[model samples]
Target: MIKWVAAFLGYFLFRFPGAVLGFIVGTFLDNFGGSGNKASSVFQDYTRQSVSPADFELNLLSLCSIIIKADGQVNQRELDYVRQYFLSTYGKEKANAIFRTFNEVIKKREVSAQRICAFMEQRTRYEVRLQLLHFLFGIAQSDGQVSKAEVEKLIEIAGYLRVGRNDFESIKAMFIEAADNAYKILEINKNATDDEVKKAYRTMAKKYHPDRVVTENEAIRKGAEEKFKEVQKAYETIQKERGIS
Candidate 1:
């Protein structure tokens, strides 16, 4: 892990030669048992409370590429959505570098959702994974409508990410409108009583809260905020329809 983080920082900061230098340094640290305390504050910057943020960004790019191509037709709006997201979370220069890396590397590769999610499943927290779903859905729906191909691809990716079926359905309901979408977003059934509906709303509100995702990354926290809003919207929709407010 140290080696991976080091290599990323090296490359991100200095490109190829720096990557080799970083790998050598990381290997030395690992051999000397530096992970306990020898890891410098600089190293810790990459590996925060959770996985390496740099690593997460690379994996996120992979997933973004997959979803963008899912419908077989790439829309400019979808492309712009990704670009705008990066620009917002990271300043223009960093965002441009990130996208530069993406276009040069990730765009050329053959993305395998199963493989990407397999790594994410082990490394990512549940709340963070849920936020990933929300982000992907936004991509799929950015072009005014989500194609059938995109939906199927998203489901497959969710399965690989090991996201629970109900959780996936709950997020899906936010973007795909349906008669029972509000109930689904609450992870409840229409047959649920008013009391049960209230309970479900509480549960979902807690689950989707932005604070649930432990991350310093503004983009991820932003995604969680969006999910949290969807949950609130769902609860409101249900209350209005049932006259239970």
Candidate 2:
């Protein structure tokens, strides 16, 4: 059990900064316990745990710091959006702690978005990665518009994470309002027939629905819900435009 825990910690130690690794190790240890046969069982359990919500939260904040700083300046609106998101998801005390870590991460000159995204791809599930992309769009649009630089950075990070073009465009359209936003959000061509539009909408709705996220964490679930709502809004916009029932 100790060997497994040490190996896991070592993996993070190599990939993440000391402070983030410390927090992750602490969280894992806090959840760890048992003796003899029980200890072996616990080790097996821990090995199967994959990535916990705490792990996801820490990585998310770290990546967020990188995205916010992508444009060479971290705007107040972007920071405020992140704070409110943390507070809503983690409560005031935990949010403050994570926010402190985020600030610390951004101050370091060595942590790049490419490294972080690669690390996240190794640890996170597909749904969580999608949510991370969605969150980045939220951060980029916090100042009421997504800049070209932010879009480029997002594409770069998504590429590192191996997020598909269709999935990435689906999330992008949710934030960027334009005449063809509905088609982009559904990942369909603008020339689709009404039946094709309906099919696309159903497919996207199923893909982005909050229930599709296989996590018990309410925060993560809520983030998925927001994406699900965006999918719904896109479908509705297309329906209205085409006068489809």
Candidate 3:
């Protein structure tokens, strides 16, 4: 872990300058694309992140919001990702505000990556930062799809968080890759028969089983509740698709 942390810090420092430049360019393009429109609102929100004072977790939340908005539209997959995270990490009031502010900000016209990074540098604790990076990767993987752009952006955020390459990859596998086949919740595939579907559900339920996770990490157990629900949902979807009651 110490080695991973050290590698993470080095990577971030190395990539810091380029990321700042890219953020500036991205913000400018967002503004130029829509001088005065709803899209412009997103740009405005993106740029103003500079002035807002936030703690590490909040800063991470803001950054995730930006990345989620990057592909042009926010869908249920991303929403489920964010909602699961906030519900797990914070109380209802704080979670509500975090979600609300995230929605409100991304609607603006411009953003300053330099300012955002400065906030992260000053405010984020190393562990919390790493966790947030992991969460963004989870969001990116929700649809079982990763674009070149999204992967690059996630790497950028990992660099900013000073997360080591190995640790970041672990995060990718744990959160992103694990959650990738979520659309499977819509139907069981040809390779999977009725018995296979039941078997998959049993496996997932055991894996995300809240009781098991709670025994391991009381802090994250409640958060696992939402994930466990997804497992159950998938099982139900498979049953419905197969007409197996």
Candidate 4:
């Protein structure tokens, strides 16, 4: 929408110097609070403050790419996970911009992880860094397990974030334990029957039922959902592998 308006106004003001001024003013006002609309001020302010020195879009892409690399294979499922996350959180236009930035970041083989880590360390808040680490861990464990590569990079990023090694180990263990429990809940193993799968799903469905969690404690709902998804994925993987009916 902004781009369309900018293009139209730019075309209209092609010739005169005043036209350039008008376009600039108009674009700025449109983005800010033009036409007596101060609605976007808070959001704009937050974005400006959050992304001043380090480009937020570029940084996010770099972090996500590193996470994808962590899994060793960089599968379509992980790529899809990234795309869906950006689309849901940042909207399609910004998501496209970030993905383009990610492509550029991936091209530079000479880029230094340490320098990038330094930039992120200096720029973002501790809370935001923790959220990012959780997100990366969630992505790595999305397919019901975490690869060694994923574990390695998780540790690397945790160190860069200045999270203590002990803390990092604890967090990693927590998520991995959660993931393993999810797999167990689904009865994923070398031998499992169709009845066992159905029974396990029923048991987990009752255990992780969102209505129960939301009613009991809203705080646990999100974690429950993630855990449940892993259970489902493990079930699917086992079923596919064993050719279960």
Candidate 5:
């Protein structure tokens, strides 16, 4: 077991080459001893190395391209929204570099939304997938409205990502304004009692909580935090409407 762990540590050390990788290797070794069949499955799933940060960024920008062009035209407001996201996550220099690459890809229109989503579904965790969906919605609504074409494209991409209908609707409510949007955001019904609303809020909060994303990637965690805030805002909106504290 010592030799096995040492071998893994050595490989990870060479592959990842950072303190975070060290911590991950240590955790893997600690869990490997007690994990059983389930642990083996987990090791196989996570240890294969999920998408790298660069690849994730590229995939995100590629998908964003699809979203912005959903209405057959790319709006500056939509591009700005994506640029702001990259700016906050990667800072000025890297964000500009990414934007340049994104523009190049956008001009070529070569990145297939279905293919990118498939890669994400196979490589990313559910929390990450949810975050991606949320980001896409933000892009869709950047022009102050989510057109039917945009929503249709988003639905198709969500399907490719294997995101559940409930989860997709939950995120969709955050952006697309409607009379019963608050209820949809909370994944509840208009006729639901205050107590039921509260329970639903708690359930959605737990599911979309940023802390649920266990990754060293700060950008991914930040994206999850945005979704968490959206869930909280939805709950608050319902509370305001129902006069529930």
Candidate 6:
């Protein structure tokens, strides 16, 4: 429906907060307007939209392909991780449609991470781009250990996506464990003052809130929720270390 497209664009343009606005406005138009399938001015400009939603899926597949081949050996667990996540988040039919492209076109060639990241940076919101990085990390770590080449590839891809060093490190910490990784996840220093830790927790929580990307999709919400839980875990770890309740 045009309304779903509108809702998706709203989220795509403004992040998750705008999804409700788009859906409500869409319903209002559906009830009050005529029976034509024309798009409203509020829905789209058509000219400005160089990237379609389908483009997101394709570019995402490209990123996955790049990562899978990063270490020069394809691990079935990593491949299964990618496929299962897609199936759970996007459903069976749609996941199959995407995998068809992945197995057919994307895997057949050397996908340029630069080209895909360039396309994504032009069209995606920062939060969504962060999610993309997180997804790649998830794939890399799915097989028990992250190979050095895989981490290097992920860092390079993050650079092309324009993700800052801290943000990239934070996502990396979520998978690649370290002693002070919890601090890294919160984007705070290991010796940050208790008050500073509290402040950082609040900030990161808001940034990674489930509502930020949870609109209209349960599995997507779960993805955001997992990130949010990491922020909580970081805060708790710091709190316990400092004996602050």
Q: Cα RMSD (Å) between model 5 and the true structure?
A: 8.6
- lDDT tens digits by residue: candidate 1, 181-212: 99999999899999999999899888888867
Choose the strongest candidate by TM-score. Answer: 1
Candidate 5 Cα misplacement greater than 4 A, ranges: 1-49, 216-219
**Clashing residue pairs for model 4:** 70-150
Query: Tens-digit lDDT track for model 3 on 86-199?
Result: 766576787788778777666765555446666665443344344456456667777667666777877776776677675565445444434434334323354676777777
Candidate 3: lDDT of 7?
Answer: 45
In what order do the candidates fall by lDDT, top score first? 1, 5, 6, 2, 4, 3
Put down candidate 2 lDDT per residue, 1-245, tens digits, no spaces: 44456556766676445445655665566566432333233223222335545566667777788778888897999999988987997789988988888888778775677877776787556776788788888999999999998999899989998999999988888888777987898899999999999998888888777766765555566779999888888889888888999
Name every residue pair that clashes in candidate 2.
none
**Candidate 4, residue 104: how far the Cα is off, in Å:** 2.6
* Clash total of candidate 5: 0
Scored by CA lDDT, what does every candidate get?
Answer: 0.83, 0.77, 0.56, 0.59, 0.79, 0.78
Better candidate number, 4 or 6, judged by TM-score: 6
Q: Judging by TM-score, tell me the better candidate of 1 and 5.
A: 1
Q: Give TM-scores for every candidate, taking all chains together and pairing residue i with residue i.
A: 0.79, 0.77, 0.46, 0.50, 0.78, 0.77
List the candidate 1 regions with Cα displacement exceeding 4 Å: 1-50
lDDT of 6 by residue, 1-245 (tens): 65687799889988887887888888778755532333322212221224555665678788888888899987889889988988998899988987898786545757789998988787555766777788788889899988999999998999998999998889889998788999999998887998899899999999988666623333345667788888899889888888987
Candidate 1 residue pairs that clash: none
Model 1 Cα shift for residue 141 (angstroms): 0.4
Ranking by TM-score: 1, 5, 6, 2, 4, 3
Better of 3 and 6 by TM-score: 6
